[model samples]
Target: MQQDRMEARTAGWGQRQGWGRRADGLARAGRRPRRVAMGAMLLVAGIAWTAQTLGANTTPVCKLSVCWASEADKLRYECDSGCYFESNPVDVEPEAVCNVMAEATHEGSFSYMYRDSVNLVTTGIGNLLASVDDAVALPFMIEENGVSRRATEQEIRDAYNGLSSQSAECIAGNPRRCNTANSYAGENALRLEEDTINQLCQTRLANEFTPGLHRIYPDFDSYPSKVQAALYDMVYNLGEGGLSPPKWPSFNRAMGRKDWQGAADESNRPQLGTTRNDYVRDLLESAADEEEAGRQRLASCASPGFP
Candidate 1:
């Protein structure tokens, strides 16, 4: 039946009765309605399956150390939910250093990026890769002795706080960010601020979050992927400390149980300065540009990954 459908699709694409070349109309004729119906069916079926198989369809992807990216662990950086972390298909021996990630049910997760190996060297077990370059694939080769597996909840908390803590230095006592090393430099502060706003929207607000991004910002329904890409780029550009989401200190104020007045007050601190004021103002405007750029980017074939 699938073969018949394929053949029909192939023949349906040939030129029509009168036209010299195959027009979209002719190509779409027999296959159009079926394809449309098929697509609808698949959507419904997929959604139903997802709902039944995975409740809520929210909070996608498990948060593990590997799910995070960091300077320390090569495989840990941007590690998806499996034993393998590399992108390009490569070979590895059976179990070694990295254990194939399994669910609580003890079932293995499947990934297009992962494949079974045969007769490959088992020195490192190479089951889970971290990163891959042109010559070698996965970061399993980068392992050392002191590394630990599966981050503890304390580690997760510590990691999150530790990473987030660095934001203050740039935004700390130095309003100008002039003394700060990573502060966006020179006349580009406007661009820097705009970028920072986007960053705020992502990491602090969104984080290069795993699996589902659309859930957090339902407001971005019209431009799901675009807003996500913009948000990540912004977070990357702006430190997680200041300049995004609630815009940092204000964000911390709220986190610290400060009321709306305090939050708004902290948020408004930039208004007190010309340079900082100009930066925020430009960022709001830049968001529109970033959104449009995001739309164009989302429209393209590119799937925006983390910054």
Candidate 2:
């Protein structure tokens, strides 16, 4: 949210701040003031970079004065000392990035237990409870007489078992709309708050999905945001192994070559809905368009000009 807020503020400033006259005045001024201004600018840039590097919302356990060349280097030193970084540096904030995947996986829903298409007992944004331990690990709340309290382990186990026992027909027929209708829509239905669901999704993205994606695509951070999101969605839907070579050979080849259109052509997943498939395709195509536009801009900049 801090990143989102910062982007909005930057956009507003861009509209009002005309840099032409200020730049000209600064140029006219002595070189000393310009040097000082440049120093100030660099300092501000460093702060912004640091904020982005360590998730804006996350507080680092320890601070290091030494500069590191990459996030991996920073993590190696920091994590060795039991320090925790919220996430790796990404084009988009971790929370916003998770939201993109959540939209496709859970469709803006964040409460109540249900069954996924494959009949897995799931809750809050497609979070799967493979066993009773998984259910008890999460702090699920239950409501009674208009009051909310944390659900006991037995209550959680009961709810999970209730959903797990549902027939495949039930799962297919009713996916259980979030916050509205569910298999157990009675007095003490187990639920998770929106913030809790977001944290769960974000944690998985940061700890599991993102690290796995990085291992597969080593230069993942360098890719365009849309491409990154597309790859992220793939990894989330189909585990890291599912997107690697031998499993998705054609897609892997296209990605290796940085061929956005080729990758888009190979991105279809028969099991997923057309809308989700289209979203991934569109992201890849959009990246291709951006790459083409960048090339055109470079060419124009290099051309001989009378001015």
Candidate 3:
């Protein structure tokens, strides 16, 4: 039946129908609505059978150093002595580390210009423009310059140069924006402010979104890191309120069931035209593959009472 649907897709008939050679339409035809509906039905049926046989919500036992708990309705694991339950994926991994690709992605879409059309100077990978009131609120903003004025372009450059090398390079076209020892010391005040602001955002995001995600998906930890990261990005960008059913019904529906592909489709809607959904889907699959390989290696090692 699936094969019949595959064969019935209209893309292959494009040439015969003189629809030109740009068959980009066929590129993602596998995601046809009917096919997705059928696949979802099969998955639900399988899960239902498994639940009936194994009992409802019976999570598998945990291994060493992994403990599960529910908070604000989210199921999470406290691992390696860290309370890494529900938090924005961006916060899970530092902006400097996690979602590097996503940030770079925005650079391409938004361009690497110093300032936007509105004359807001940019700095970081997401271009962290000065136009955002939050940027002004960044602790790096100096009040007692004795002049009691907004930071000048030079001051902004000096402040950012001290804290983030990667972002500074992207912004200033110089990897060593603050190379000299004296140069570094000169920006000490600004650097302190930058660190404070960074910490503030992290704290705020964790407090705001962590419990909300817990409420949205109780078994959040069981989800692939990529999926968690994507969800974090969504909430971070749109806020918990914006991520609700009225704003993103399909994403909410697919995500509620851990249907990553379906969720990806919902995220990759044509109107949005963003690669975030596909990126997360790929990351999740890649992470799963790596884990499977690690398990296979461990199994091989454990043969004959451990090598």
Ranking by lDDT: 2, 3, 1
Clashing pairs in 3: 75-218
lDDT per residue, candidate 2, 1-307, as tens digits? 8774553233212112333234445657843223221111222332321211222322222222222445445444443332332222223456766687667442445577765665666667667778879989988998799999999999988887766455555445543422233544453478888898989888888788888977887656545557777887788788777887788889988887778788999999887778889988988887776656544433443346401
Candidate number with greatest lDDT? 2
Q: Alpha-carbon error at 60 in model 1, in Å?
A: 21
Off by over 4 Å in 2: 1-91, 104-108, 164-188
Q: Candidate 1 at residue 169, lDDT?
A: 35
What global local distance difference test value does model 1 have? 0.26
- Candidate 3: which stretches are off by over 4 Å? 1-91, 94-102, 106-137, 142-197, 269-274, 284-307
Colliding residue pairs in candidate 2: none
Best by TM-score: 2
Every model's TM-score: 0.20, 0.65, 0.41
> For model 3, what is the error of residue 124's alpha carbon versus the real structure, in angstroms, after optimal superposition?
6.7
Indicate the TM-score of model 1: 0.20
